[model samples]
Every structure is written in structure tokens, then in C-alpha cells.
Target: MTRSVYVTSIERGDGRQIVELGVMELLTRRVDRVGVFRPLVHDGPDRLFDLLRSRYRLTQDPATGYGMSYDEASTVQAEEGTDELVSRLVDRFHALARDYEAVLVLGTDYAGSQLPEELALNARLANEFGAAVLPVVGGRGQSAESVHTEARNAHRAYAQLGCEIPALFVNRVTPADREEVRDQLAAHLPVPCYVLPDEPALAAPTVAQIAQALQGTVLLGDDAGLARDALDFVFGGAMLPNLLKALTPGCVVITPGDRADLVVGALAAHSAGNPPIAGVLLTLGERPGKEILALADRLAPGTPVISVAGTSFPTATQLFTLEGRLSAATPRKVETALGLFEQCTATGELLDQISAPRSTRITPMMFQHQLLERARADRRHVVLPEGTEERVLHAAEVLLRRGVCDLSLLGPVDSIRKKAADLGIDLGRARLVDPTTSELRDDFAARYAELRAHKGVTLDLAHDVVADANYFGTLMVEQGLADGMVSGSVHSTAATIRPAFEIIKTATPKAGPGTAAGGEPAAAPIVSSVFFMCLADRVLVYGDCAVNPDPGARQLADIALQSAATAERFGVEPRIALLSYSTGTSGAGADVDKVREATELARARRPDLPIEGPIQYDAAVDPVVAATKLPGSAVAGRATVLIFPDLNTGNNTYKAVQRSAGAFAVGPVLQGLRKPVNDLSRGALVGDIVHTVAITAIQAQEPG
Candidate 1:
């Protein structure tokens, strides 16, 4: 079966942009079998129509067809000589309606604009045909009041003409007016209203909605119903004033005024008519300050405020686990909270069951203080590089003032702090350093001048090199100041890697230019990956994820070595599973041959690797199946580190298991680099950025 939507512009308005986006968002969720039919699409290059066609392409099965008979030719051609264009309009819409499940009739212009009669005719035809008529309103320089009034009147006209419960979509609304319009629309109209967020990104559940879907409770107030849509957290002491200013009509939890200051800032933000915050949550054992009380009295008036006496972190933890909004009875709320906590625990247990194969073979008792000695001696030093990104830098500042790690930042001092302030990134305990601000500026200048002096790098340029924070930070790892360095925020892959290759190429060659696998191999570092699949206390290791695209015989051996090395660092015993197309090499091909060679290589590289390979995907992991397939293969059934042959197989396989099997992947976490140099996709999200930062820091640890 094919699903198609026919969009008609009532007048020559720009509602099509939103008409297209909303439809696409709906399609991603609701429709699977999709096709498109544009009834009477106007001719001569209609960009809006063209853009709609582009969006439709992404939602449908990539291999379907699209028809544009309606839009390409005016309705006049379909029903000529009756009402001139009106006859054809009804005929075309009716024709498309018969073909598609739901036809979205988009009202383009107002009744007053060109062809108001034609607009009315189209609306009536839409009613007669039983289509979903959505008023998509847009104005380049028009007033919001006028556009809104126009939309409302259109809805009234459609209803009076015997249309079904119709909806109005306010298009290209100024972000500031969106909430207000929604508020106003709710009271006057008698229909379901869905506000499209002000973003072009493909729609998914809202973050708030996502939280709600997780079946969690809102924490700020006692009345869980109020916290469903959390605006922000309010710090205790200084929050009252700011709470009044910035509370975003959701739940606000306050702690000390230090925390209160955040609340005040949030409340002051709401204006003569901004979205008012939901409520206030007073946390910890602190009383509200005078300023806070005054502000709260005036700003909130009778808004409900909940008080809980617990530490801020604990308070947040409770709030997060509550499974958003509890307007229900107390007993019901308690059950929901307990259930959610248990669910989280169960997710944690799943993680604990996955262990590294043979990782417990060697356990050391003594601890070393110096990272240099630890890294070289232990072969696994967990390092955490102090970061300069907004969240990290703030955390770094906290750590520095508080003394957290041997820190390194990637830019000039003044610039870093300025950017940090602009972004409101907390410095936490981080010690800020300008690689360019060190005492060895001249020494760096002299050295860099000698190395790349001919690359147009004058003595002055050399000074800049010594002064460059990222360059200096990478140098720390190269010169053994830190065991490893993870950095890429202020630099590129090329810039981050060049310094390391120049200063610390490798103690020995990696298995090869790429990855090492196979039965034949001398001991060497090979490509591997480590993913910290975190489930509360269940932090398991998954490898060959970050490095080694596809393995040949030799590369597989290297993957084992690297995988084993990473597992040891994270304290998980290594259990290797060499996955294959067919178990026991029942199939013959270059792939099986590669897996066989790789298994042979692993036995040689890490003699106690506890590895099993040339095994089918099921036999390699399922104990019940493994017991039958390879009777005595130790790693067959309980493999944690799944080694794949190539990226086409590994990348797709991991993602599927992650989504289908309810698993999470942490990193291809770039492993086997001379120094830590990871690449971020052009459009990585903030969470991705956070994980990468942690990985880099852990890599900086000395071998011990």
C-alpha cells in the first residue's frame, strides 16, 4: 500500500515550509509505507513545493516513487470551464484523496488576499472531500495579531462550511511569540493543538517528553504534576529573586542562595509576558533569604513551592528517578518511584553480566604515585585530561582550584577564560594553563624552529608554537609530563596528531600501518577499541570499536592485544570472541581465512587471551549454543570483546545491538594512537563531546 499527502495553498502564502516540516515529523513516527501526490502544484519553479518534495524523500522508503501531477499543472486543467479554477480544485483534491490515506490540505493565503473567492472555494471543496485542512500561516513583515486573526477566521470559515475539527499552524513565528500564541489559542479554540518547536532538526520527542517517556518523576516540588515540565533548577540561598525572574513555568528546585542566585537569574528572565515558571523547590536545610522571599512573593504570588531537606545532589537524584509528574495519590506515586528505581537497577545488572574474557589473569597489588613510572611499568595508566570545553573547563577550574588532575588546556589563557565566561562554563577545580604561557617559551621556539623552521616558521612563529596551549598540551604527553593527552576541541585531527607523531611516534610499530591480526605475529601494539557501556555499577568493556576498520589475520591478533590492554586498564578481565560468518569455518572464503589467521595471531600475541574465533555470531556469545558448537572453546559462549572483520560489519552490527537489544555504545574510543587524538563528526552533540573528554583524560594516565 502507498501513502500520499496532497498539500494545497489556499492563497499564495508561505505556510508550506512548516506544512512540509510538520508532515515530515509526523511521517517519521507514523507512516512507513509512503508515497506523495501533489494535486495541482503550481508550475514555473515553486521552491516551497520543491522543498516539500525534498523533505518527503527522507521519510519514505528510499526506493519509492513520487507523483506531482496536481501541483505541476493548475486545477484549471483538471476541472476546466466550471468555476474556472474552483471546479478543477475540487476535482484534483478529490482525485488525490482517493489515492492517499490522509491528505493534508495546506491553506496558503488569507480570504482577503488574491483570489479570496478561490480560497473559499478550495476550503469548501476540502470540506466536501473530507480532508485535514491545516491553516499554515507565515508573514515576512506582517503583524502577529493580523496573521493570528487571519488563521482563526480561516478556521471559523472552514468549520462553518461543515469541515471537521480543523487545526491552525502558526508558521515562521518569532520564538518570543510562540508560547504566548499557544496560551491564547488554547482558550479560544475547541481543537487539539500541537506546537512545532522552533527547530529545523528532524523531530523526536521533546527532551521533556523524552524524560516523561522514561517513566520518571519530576523532582522540584511535592506536587509531581507541576514538575512534569521542568524549567530549571533553583539553587537554595540566593535563588528566590532569580527564581521570580527566570522560573520557566515548570519545576524549580532551590538549594542555598549560591543555588538561589541561579533561581533569581531564571525568574528575572520571564517578562511582562514570558512563559512563567511552574513552581519553586526549596532544597537542603537553608531558609530563604530576604531578597528571595520578596521576589518570590511578587513573582510567583500563589504558585506552589515544595521544600525538601536533602543535599543538592541527592535531591536531584530523587527528582530524576521520580518518573515525571505525579498528580495521582501518594501511594501511587510511591509505587511508581520504587518501580523506576528497580528498572534502573535491572539495567545495571545487565551490564554487570558482560565481562572481559581472561582479564583477571594478572592482578597487581602495589600502587605507584608517578604517572610516568606507572604508565611505563603497568602498561595501563588511566588518565583524565583536564578539558577546555564549556562543561569540562568549568569542571577543570573546579578541579584546579580543588586540585583534580595533572591538567592541560588547548588555547591561550585570556581567550579560554573569556570564552568560558561567554558560555557560562564552570571552571570547577581545573588549573588553567596557556601552553604559550610556560617558562620554556624560548626553548619551544628554539626546538620548533629547528624542526619546521623551513616550513615558513620564523623565530616569532616558533614563539607562538611554544605558546600554543594545544601544542604544549600534546607535548606534555610526548615528553612524559602526562602519560597520555586527549585533545581536539581547539585543534583538528591533523594538528592534534602531527605533534605526537613528531615527538612520540611509538615505542614499537603498531601491528602495521592499520591493524594487526593473524596467527603469525611478533609482539606489537595493535588497533583496538574500548567502550565503557555504563549501566550504573555495570561498566563493561567492548572493544575493537574505535580503531581497526577490518581485520586481516595479522590485524586480529593486534586487536586482541589492544583490547586486552584496555580491559586491564578499566579493571575488567578480557574474554575474546572472534566472530565469523559461519561457526567452525563451515564456510570457506577470505573472511574465514582472515578470522582463522587472526585467532592464531591472538594466541601468539597474548598467550593467555582466553580467545575463541572462526565462530558463528550466536555460538561465540550464547553459552547454550556455544556448549554445542565448540565443546571445549573457553571463550565461545562468554565473549565480551566482539572482534569484527571490517567497518561495514562492525559499525552496523554494534548500532543494531545497541538499539534492538537495548544496549549503549560509548566509544570507538580512538585507541592505539601514539598520543590521544580523536576525531569528532562535523555535528557532534554536547553529550558526545562530554564522553570524549573523559576518555581523553583517562588516556593521560601513566602506564602503571
Candidate 2:
């Protein structure tokens, strides 16, 4: 039998799409076969259903997901009474359920339905379908007391209809009242009540929506530019200087077409990436000259420059009234919604309450999600030394928005703020520190001098060194100011970690029961790295690929041990393969001997580790090759961690797999450091930085 949950809202504009998205995410995490169904949907394009299908990779046909249109359903209900409506919906839902392990039933939007009692109708349908109810109540403009009362009343209404209410949510509550409302509702309601703060982006209008409302022409813009939400409206009646100061990120500029100066200035501001505006809207149906339009396109490539027949006043009114919709075209909005849902709700507990079984296989998306969930569990503070970098700031916005971790960005405070404002990103509780002008400069210098005194470093030299952002961030970690650090988006790897070697040094693990009499760890400590090679089906750890050009036998052993530990830390079982050109002594050479010796040393040090030696790349991972080459070796065919004989082989193999095989390589994650500090590739994307920062935060959770 297919299990199902009904996501319904009490009133219109409750913003229940966030709840639906959250539930879909949770269900997909638990089961591979999940379906979506809607009892009655509005006419036109079902944007919400389309988004869910695209995002979750649903296979259910759109025609099968819905029972009937709102008009048809209302007519049926009015003529045949409610019984026929409920019976018809139940049949459609079961058809969807038959092919899925779990069905997520999206309830009515409470719009255009002629049913006398919509809430009662939803409760009846949920009960008939034998699905648990998750109700959402709108609290955007309500007081705390009003929200609490409405929530209690909603629960009562559903319960009065004999519906099984697993949980209730009050979304779009004011931030000031969110916590108190949550506490009061949790205490007052029988079921769990989650309070979600109002997200302005959810209510803002996109440029496309604005253009559609005004019946405007796309003078110059693309589909991507059209999809951006117009968070604010900046009318360009003022001079360039004054208008620039008023510009906010995602704001749309509305001006007369004759104001070519304003158009050029706005595009230039966007091109500089200060605060990227949504697009430019030209009023009075007037277009700029040919040269001006060409210059504008070159200034901000692909930015929308819409021309409306309506004047400024009417256009502004229509734009304000036009709200953003949850659609397949607006994926960034989907991310924002998911982030808010995860931040406000007790996702793990809610999933447990929903009783969705956890998945066994870890996909790339799952790995990234788990990294974030773990980091948020016991939140840590991370400092980004490349604060001025655009990618870093973008990642910071995502991190802060999702409540991933507390951030302390190191750069010029004024410059960072201006840049963020120009980009229209919200730092949201992130602390900014100017490394050169911070009051802690002297104290940091003194500490650095003390730590490096044996190197004959004077106070003056220490002061100058500490002024560097990387050195300052490293010292912050050493002095226990931040949990970890992530840099190297622009700086070299050596410049990023050199200070750590001098000050933090390598950590010494505690001796285990099989250690020497002096309580020293069995293996000599060494710093190594691994890339979590995220394939389509599973994640494998490729070690020493980015560090240690050519490690010897003992160093290789240490790298294997560290890689095994790192693999286990990130939730991958370690079946290690010591790789070389030969397989199980089939060939003899210096390379094979080195791998053989390293395997022996690793086994001698950690007898419990599962390891194999002198394995080729094919034999290490391919079961067919393993069956022929090394009959029944445990690690030959299914190694999760591959230890390379030298950097030349490891680097080339990882790059080949990453590029040719289309796998995501998520590291060069530094291991065996005194504190958790990771580096990013110079060409890393925003999502890459976000993942690296999450990895660093998770590492900070462990003992260095």
C-alpha cells in the first residue's frame, strides 16, 4: 500500500508551497519512488506542480496528478453534493498511489471553489484518502495572539472533521513575533506547531511578472533576466549620484527613455557587480538610441531592459501588486523557500514524526544535504578571508540565509558592505572585520610573535605578517576566536596553510590501547588531502590527490590511515586500495614495491583497517576485472578509498574521472591539521564554496 500525506492550507495566500516543497524534499530523502497528486487545481499552468515535478524528478504524468479543475470540481460538488467529489478524488489519488511508494497529495488552493465550506471539504477528502493531514495557517499580518488563536482554531476545524493532524505550521509570521508565537503555539496546540518567518522574496514580483502585467516589450533582456524578482522599485528621476545611493539588489529601475544617463549608470553599476539590479524598465514607451542600447548591452550583458506603454505611476502600482509565484522558471526562489523551510522547521524530528524511512544509499545531493544538516545541528563560526570576492559573498548570503553557520568575513568593513549592497545580498547577522584596522590587531601580533619567538620574529615583523588576511584568519582559529577558516579562492594553497604549519602545527591523536608504552600514536603524523568523488550513485574518497607530491612508504601509510579516518568521518565506509600499475604482485617494479611496502606498513600500524595493495585502477574499482585479476580480495573490486602511489598518478586519475566521467570532485579537503581550515579552488563556484564551507564546519565539529 502507498502511504500518503495531505498538505493543505486554512486560507488563501498561506504560502503553503514552502511546506509542500519541504515535505517533498523529506519524502525523496526517505524513498526513491514518491508521487504527487492534487485533488483540485486552478486553471492555466499548474506552476507549483510543475516545479515539484522538475525538482524531484517525478515520473507521474501531469494529467494523472490532478483529479479535475476547480470549476469542474465546484460544479460537481454543487450538483451531486460532496459525496461524489470525495469519491472521485479518492479514485484519482489511488491511481497515483499505486505506482509510488509514497504519495504527496497537494490539497486545494482555496481559490475559485464554489464549495460552501472549503476547509471542511479538504478535511473530508484527506480522511477519505486515508492520508495524514499537515495544515498550514497564514499569519503574515496577524499579531502573535491572533496567530496562536487561528492556529488552535485550524487544528480544531480539521479535528472536528475527523482528520488526522500530524503537524501544523504558521507561515509568514513577523520575525519579531516568530519565536514567541512558536513557543506559545507549541504549548497551546496538541500537535507540533512550527513558525516560519515571512520571506519578502516570496511576495516580491519578478521582472517577467511585472512586464506581463504592463504588457511591455522586451527591448533588451533574456529569459534568465526576466525571471529575477523585482525586490524594489527605483525610479530614475534623480541625478546619477543620488539614484545610485538608492539602488538595492534585485531592484528594478523605472525611468523615462530620454534619461540615457540613468540607463548607462544603472547598467554600469550592475556590470561592476556592486549590487546587480533585476533589470531596467523604460517608461513612456520610449526607447534609447542605437548607440545607447548597444552600450547598455555591453555594460550588463543579458540584463533586461523592458519598455512599457504605461506611464510610471500606473506601472509602479501594477508592479507592486504583482507577486512572485512558485514556478519551474524560478528555481532560485525554490531554493530560498527550501532554505527558509529547513531553517524554521525541526526537519529531522518532523521526518521522524511523519515516519518516513531513511534512505540507505548516499547520493551526491544527499551528501551535501547531510553536510548542511550536521553543520546546523551544533552550529559553528567560520571566517572567510577572501571577503571581497564575489563568489565568497554569494556563498555567505546562502549560508546566512539557510542558518548554516555564523560567519565572520575578513575585509574592509565599508567596502564589504557597499559591495554586498550593490549585489543586493543580505549578510543577515554575519560579522565583518577589517583585518588591517581591527582593534585586535595588536593582540594578534603579540600572540603571533610569542608563537614564532624561536624563529627570531620581532613584534614589528609579526605585526606586518598578521595584517595579511590569511595569517590573521589562521591566528583567529589558533586563538579560539573562530571554529575554522575557508580561503584560497584567490590565494595559493601554500599561502593559505603556511601560517597554520607555523602556529597551529599538526594535532597529535590520543594513543589507543595498542599504542606504545609512552602513549604515542602508532603511526607518524602527516598532512594529506582527499577529494570526495561524488558519482551518480555513490561517493568515493580519492586520497592524497592534491597534497604530498610523492610520499614514501611510511608517509603513504599515514596518508591511508588519515584518508580512512576522513572517509569514515563523512559517512563513507573505508575499503582502501593501495594503487599502482601492478595488481597483487603480477608485475615487479619500484612503484609496485612502494605500494606493497606501504600496505604492509599500514596493516602493521592499524591491524583493523581493511586494505589491499599493488592494485591497478581498473582492478581497484571494476568487479569484472577484479574477478579475473585478484580472485576474491575484499578491497579489490569495491574500494571506497583509493590511495595513490604518487601525486602524478592520483592527480591525473581524479581529473580524468571528474572531467571525462562527469563526476563532482568536492575537495582537496585538508586533513591532519591542528584546526579545521580548508581551501577552495581559484575557479570554484558559489555552490562549491558553500559545500566547502559546510565540510570545514563539519570538520570543526570533530577533534582536530
Candidate 3:
């Protein structure tokens, strides 16, 4: 039987879409094939469903997502009674459920449903569909006591109707009242209650949404500007100077199209970023002349300028009632909604309650999801040295919006701010540090000099070197100002990791139980790197790919051990394979001899580990070749961690697999460091940086 979750709310305006989106995220994280079904939808496009399809990359047909429209459902209920209506919905739901491992059943919206007793109708549908009910209660403007009563009533109502409610959610409460609401409901309710505070960003309409709602023409601006949220409305009826004073950040300016002076002033102010407005909404269908439009375009390159057929008064009325919807077009809002849901809810416990079976295979999406969940669980402060880079800035926006971890962006503060503004990115609460002008520079310089004193480094030279962003960021990690550091978007791998090698250093091996009290210490660990080859079915670990050029038997064994630990940390079981040009004793060469020796040494050090060596790539991964060449070996044909004898072979093999097999290669992730510091390829995309940052944060969670 397919597991399913029925998300329903007591009334409208509960902002249940956030809960829906969050639950969808949780489901997709665990299972590969998840479907969405709405029992009764409005006539137009379903915004939330569209978002789910786009975000999760669903292949289910849109026609199968809905049972029927509100009109058809109302008429059916009115003519054939509730039983027929529910039966038809149940049949439609099962049609989708049969093809999916789990289905998310979106209950009816009470806004325009003519069918009476929507709460009971939803409960009946949920019971019929055999889904665990997750009810939502709106607390947007309600008092604590009122919200408490409503939450209790909702749970009781569902329970009485024989619906299995796993949890109750109270969304859109004030931040001050969030805890109070949760505590109050905990005392009265039998199930866990999660409370989400109201986020203005989620409620604020974007410029594109407003334009679509008003059916206006977008005269200027690109997609980035259109995505800005309209947090406030400013009616531009006064003079230019007066209008300038009234403009606020993220506010939309509503004025007549003929008012060129006000338009020019607003655009100029926006260009200066005095108070960056969302966009200008020109009313009365009147637009500026070609000359003025051209000038306005120059004033604010990407800022939106819209022309609507309605006058200012009517536009204001429409704007007041319009709210943001979670759709494919609004990605930032999706991040905000997910962040809010994850913060307020006991996600793991709730997911357990939903009880969807985990997939046997680890897809690329599942790997990425696990990375984020682990990183967000124990939030760390990570520093990015390339703050002015466009890709870094965009990734920072995603990191902050998703609440993955605390961030400190290193660069000139003014330059960073200007770049972010031009890109229309809101870096909320990200610490911006300019190494040259920062007070910490002197202290960092002193520490660097002290660490490098053996190299005869003076204070002046150390000061200048520490002024470099990479060095400054590494110092932040070394001095405990930051937990981890991720760089190398534009720098070389050596530039990114050199400071760590100089300051943080590698972990010193500890004394074992059998060692004498005053005996010499064990060999210190070497810093090696691994690439997580995310294949279609499973993830593999390829180590020493980007760090070491050549290694002896002992160092190769050490790399195998480090790679195994890194694999286990990332949830991949380690079946070690020491790759060589030959399989077993089939051929004789120095490289094969090294791999065989390394395997023996690794096994001697960790006797319980599954280690096999002198194995060809085909013998290591292909079962047919393994059976013919190295039969009855535990690690052969099932190796999750592959250690190469040299960097040349390792790097080339990983690149070949990545390009030929269409695998996602995440890393060059450095291992065996005291603290986490990872490098990125110079051509890294925004998503690659985001994943690296998450990986760094997760590595920081490990104890020294």
C-alpha cells in the first residue's frame, strides 16, 4: 500500500501552502516517486501544484492531479449526495497513488468551495483515502488564547470524525506568540503541534505577481527585478522631493504614467539605492515618451516599470488585497517558506509520523537533501572569501534563505553591498567583513606571525599576507571566529588551502592503548581530498584525486582510511578498493605491488574494514569481471570507496566517469583537516558552491 499525507486546514488564509510545500520537501527527500493530488481545485492553474512539479521535477500529468473543479464537485455533491462525490475523489486519488510510492493529497480550500461543511468533507475524504491527516490552524491575527482554542477544536474535530491526525500546525502567528501557542496546544492536544511565525516576505506579493494580477504591461525590468517582493505601497501623488522621502525599501511606487518627474525621481533614487523600491506601477494606462522611457531604463537598469489600465485609486484597492502565492515563478518565496517550516516544525518526528518508506537507491537529489538536512541540523558559521563574485553572492542568498548556516562574506563592504543590490539579492544577516578596514586585521596578523614565526615571518609581512581574503577567512576559522571556510571559486586550490596548511594544520595521531607513557607519537595524518561521484543509482567516493600526486604504501593506506571515514560521515558505507592496473596476481608491476601492499597495511591497521586491492576498475565495479578475476572478495564489485595509487589515475578516472556516465561530481572535498576548508573549481556554478558550503558546514560538526 502507498503511504499518503492529507494536508487540510480548518479555514482559509491559514497559509497551509507552506506546510504543504514543506511536507512535499520531506517526502521527496525520502522517496523518489512522490505524487500530488488535489481533491477539489479552483478553475485556474493550481499555483502550489505547479510549484511542486517544477521544484521536485515531477513527471505526473497535470490532468491526473485534480479530481474535478469546484463547480463540478459542488454540482456533484448537490445532485448525487456526499457519498458519490467522495467515491469519485477516492477513485481519482487511487489512480495517482497506484503509480507513486507516496501521494500528497491537498484538501479543499474553504475560500470558494460551495460544498457545505468543508471541515467534515475533508475529514471524510482523508478517512476514505487512508491518509494520515495533518491539520493546519490559522493564527495570523488571532490572540494566543484564540489560537489555542482553534487548534484544539481542529484536532478534536478530526479525531472525532475518525481521521488519524499525526500533528497539528499553527501557522502565521507572531514571533512573540509562537512559543506560547505551541506550549498552550501541547498542554491540551494529544499530538505534537508545530507553530510557524508569520513571514512578511512570504505574504508580500512580487512585482511580477502584481503585474499579472492587474493584467499590466511590463514596460521595463528583467526577471530579477520582477522577482522582488512588494513589502509596502507608496502612492506617488506629491512632488518629486516629497515622493522621494516617502519611498521605502521593497515598496512599490503607484502613480500616474504621465508624471515623468516623479517617475524620474523614483528611478534615480532607486539607482542610488537610497531606498531600493520593488518597482513602479504606472496607472491610467498612460506611459512616458520614448526619450523618458529610455532614460528611466538607464536610471535603473533592471528595476521594473509597469503600466496598468486602471487608475491609481483602483490599483491601490487591487494591490491591497493581492497576496503572494507559492509558485514556480517565486523561488525566493519558496526558500522562505521552506526555511520557516523547517525552523518551526519537528521535521524528523513529523516525517516518521508520515511513515513513508525510504528509497533503496541514493539519487543525486537525495544526496543533496541529506547534505542540507545535516548542515541545517547543527548550524555553523562559514566564511566565504570571494564575496564580490556573482556566483558566490547568489549562493549566499540561497544559503541564508534556507537557513542552512550562518555566513560571513569577506570583501570590501561597499563593493559587496553594491553588487548584491545590482543583482537584487537580499543577503539577510550575512556578516560582511572587509579585511583591510576591519579591526580584526591586526589581531589576525599577530596570530599569523606567531604561527609562522619559525619561517622567519615578520609582523609587517604577516599583516600584508593576512590582508588577502583567503588568508583572512582561514584565520577566522583558525581563531574560532568562524566554524569553517569555503573558497576557490576564482582562486587556485593551493591559494585556497595554503593558509589552512600553514595555520590550522593536520590532525596529530593520538597514542594507542599499547603505547608507552613517554614514547614517540604516531605519524600525523596527511591532507587528502575526495570527489563524491553521484551516479544515477548510488554515490561513490574517489580519493586522493586532487591533493596528492604520488604516495608510498603507508601514505596510500592512510588515504584509504581517511577516505573511508569521509564516506561514512556522508552516509555511504565503505567497501574499500585500492585500484591498480592489474587484478590480483594477474599482472606484475611496481604500481600493482604498491596497491597490494597498501591493501595489506590498511587491513592490518583496521582489521574489521573490508579492503581489497590490486584490482582493476572493471573487476572492482563489474560483478561479471569480479567473479571471473577476483571471486569471493567482499569489496570487489561492491566498493563504495576507491583509492588510487597516484593523482594522475584518480583524477582522470573521476573525470571520465563524470563526463561519460553523466554523474554529478561534488568536491575535491578536502579531508584529514583540523577544521573544514573546501575548494571549488574556478568554473563552479551557484549550485556547486551551495553544496560545497553545506559539505563544509557538515564537516565542522565533527569533533576534533
Best by lDDT: 3
Please list the C-alpha lDDT of all candidates, in the order they appear: 0.48, 0.86, 0.90
Candidate 1 lDDT tens digits, 1-704: 22333234445444344454435333322332233433334335544334445534324321122223343223343445325554545565555545444444443333332233555655655555555555554533446566566556756876676755435555545556666666666677776333333321111111233233434333222222232344345444443554454344333444443365555444443322234444445555555566776685554333334455566677667555432322222222222222222221221221122110122122211110111123322232212232445544543433332122345555555556444433323343344566655675677677777767667778887787666555565556555666555555444655655565555554454342223345333435543555645422234455555445666677676666676666666555667777788887577889888888888777765665687778877887678998988888888877666777776677677666656765544554656666664443223334444445445555655232
Report how far residue 162 has shifted in candidate 3, in Å. Answer: 0.4
lDDT score for residue 548 of model 2:
92
Instruction: State the local distance difference test value for candidate 3.
Output: 0.90
Give candidate 1's whole-model lDDT. 0.48
Ranking by lDDT: 3, 2, 1
| Cα lDDT for residue 408, candidate 3 | 98
Question: In model 3, where is the ten-residue run with the lowest total lDDT?
Answer: 513-522
Query: What stretches of model 3 exceed 4 Å from their correct place?
Result: 61-63, 258-261, 271-273, 284-299, 510-524
- Decreasing TM-score order of the candidates: 3, 2, 1
Q: List model 2 lDDT by residue over 123-162, tens digit each.
A: 9989888888999999999999999999999999999999
Identify the runs in model 1 with alpha carbons over 4 angstroms from their true place: 1-388, 394-406, 422-428, 435-442, 448-469, 480-483, 489-495, 509-522, 525-528, 535-540, 659-662, 673-701
Candidate 2 local distance difference test against the native: 0.86
